[model samples]
Structures are given as structure tokens and as C-alpha cells.
Target: MARRQRTPRRTDDNLPSAIDRFDDAVDAAWGRVFRGHPVADRIFYLASEVGDFSVLWLLIAATQGLRSDEDADASIRFSLLILGESLLVNQGIKRLVHRPRPTPTEPRPLHVRSPMTSSFPSGHASSAMAAAHLLSKRSPRLRPAIYLLAGIVATSRVHVQVHHASDVIAGAAIGTAYARLADRCVPGALP
Candidate 1:
């Protein structure tokens, strides 16, 4: 019998393929609920917005803040560390996939602007999920707010059409896994 060659799956092939269908449904639902409401649209818009330079500075500040904290800040510091690591992982994946933005050739409208870079595995959604998972684990009371924010961040990518539904889903999974790994490593780091 002749051997059949197995082709390697592209990194993008590993991303969630169901995002288009799922996003359509989600968009339909949101369209019905927030129809013609500028405030609601703006809220959704802001939720998905990522100031690249600002986020980089914030992450740097967060790491510095964590390092400065004493025993009382253990949980917060741990969570930030986990989230930061997850964001790094997400960045790596984005580079590996190197998928183009959802609309590569078209001129994006003002409100729908996004960076002209790779778009598989959204960084914003990844960071938001990492923070939400870590915070939820550390403080039960904050779970609702954390999850709500994560959901909004994930949905925002689709709202602006910067990512397909699959990108956010994969980013969320990666972020969650990184958060769990970080949590496990944190306790061992303490002398």
C-alpha cells in the first residue's frame, strides 16, 4: 500500500472554525437588543478598543506594582503575573499564525479602526480572559464582573469585525490555560 502523505495543518486551521456562524448569531442577538442606541453602540465600541501603547505601559506598570507589593498583595500580584504571561503567549501565537485582518483591502471606517497586523487569536480577548479567570479564582465576589468584562472584550472583536468568532474563542482558551499554569507555578515560587 502506498503511504498517504499527511499535510501539516496551518496554525489558523487550529483556530475555532465555528466563529463565523456563532458570530452571526451573536450579532443578530445584539442587534435586536441594542438597535439604534448610540450609547449602547459606544459602550460596545469602547469595550473592544485597545490602545496598544497604553496597554503596553499599563502592563509594565502592573508588573512593577506587583514587584513592589509585600505579602498582602500576593493574590493581586499573582493574578497580574498570570495575565501578563498569557498576553505574551497570545502575542506569540498571533505572530505564528500571521493571519491577515478580517478586511485586508478595504478602508476601515473611522469607528471600526484596528491595527494593520495579524488577527488570529485576539490579544485583547486573551488578556481579558486571563485576568477574568485569575481574578475569579482568587476572589469569588469579583467573578461576575470579571466574566462580564471578558465577554464584552471578546464580543468587541467581532463587533468591529477585526476578528472572526474563532479568533476570540482560541484566545480565550489559550488565556485560560496560561492562567491555570501561572496559578500552579505561583505557590511554588514562594520560599
Candidate 2:
């Protein structure tokens, strides 16, 4: 008897399949929109780079910490908190989800950082929003700028083709949830 050839499993699912298709559309759109601007690509590359290991957030926390002794204490706390966030997202959660990063069909538009982590959730997106939440406490007046920076950092992950748009969206949600949870559970813990 001849054996039957097995086909790949596809549920023809609604939400999951729809989401994947939408994400692909967004990724393709991003490629088309930024196709030929070397300078724009470089800027995105650098923005994504700065998000590595939450360096940008740490810097902002340190700057805020420098303002006063109280601020210094808060800065230290916030920095540690961001690091803790990194640990949770990178080590704890990423290890469980083995999602792959987006693969570019053509030569990359610009240089991009090769990260060693799951693509299900973007670490850059997580840290950026988390830091925005904590650091905004330092100067409430700069809230808009702080969140804007966070938005830029989070989206840069997608623009540079290192992460899918859903990954970024989920990561931002996780980061926001974590920040809020930290605020509620550990009162006065974050800056």
C-alpha cells in the first residue's frame, strides 16, 4: 500500500491566521515605505540599537537620578526595576516562546542588530514603555516627550525588521502591564 503524503497543519483559524496575515501586510508596508532612504534607515537602526539592554532607559533614569538625593534614590530603584523587567521578558518569558524573528527576503535596507531572544515579544518595546512609565515620574512635565521616545524605541524594532508588529504590540502591552503591576504591588518601588 502506498503511504499518503502528509501536509502541513493549518487550522484556517480566524484570529491567529488573520493576525498573521495582517502582520505580514504591515511588515511589507514598512519595507515599501522605507525602501530607499539610507538616512532614515540609519536613524531607525540607531534607535533600535539604543534600545539594546534597555540602555536608553537606564540613561534617562540616571539623568533623573542626578537631580536630587531623593531623585537619585528613585533613579536607582527605577533602574533596578527596568533591569528586573529585562530579566522577566528576556530570560523568563522569551525562553518559553520560541518564535522566530522576521526574515527579510531581500538584502536588508540597513544594518540591524542581531538579537539573541525570541521574537514573540520585543525586549526593546517592553523596556521602552516600562521605562517611560517609571521615568515619567521624575518630571511629570516631560511626560509627552518621554512617552514619545518610548513609542519611537518600540516601533523601531519593527521598522528595522528585527521584530513583527504583533510582537511589538504584545511587548508594549506586557511592558505596560508589568509597570502597572509593579506600581500596585510594590508601592513606591518605581520612580
Top model number, TM-score: 2
Full-model lDDT, candidate 2: 0.85
Strongest candidate by lDDT:
2
Task: Please give the CA lDDT of all the candidate structures.
Answer: 0.62, 0.85
- Please identify model 1 stretches exceeding 4 Å from their true place: 1-36, 50-72, 75-83, 104-113, 188-191
TM-score of each: 0.66, 0.88
Candidate 2 regions with alpha-carbon error over 4 angstroms:
1-12
- Model 2 TM-score? 0.88
Model 1 global lDDT (CA atoms, 0 to 1): 0.62
Residue-wise lDDT of candidate 2 within 16-133, one digit each (tens)?
7787898899988887887457886777778898889888888888888788898888988887789889999999889999998888656776677788789979999999888888
Q: What is the C-alpha lDDT profile of model 1 across 70-151, one tens digit per residue?
A: 4236444654575466457555676688876664223323375556657877776777777677656645775797688778
Tell me the deviation in Å of residue 3 in model 1.
10
Report each candidate's C-alpha RMSD, comma-separated, in the order given: 5.7, 6.2
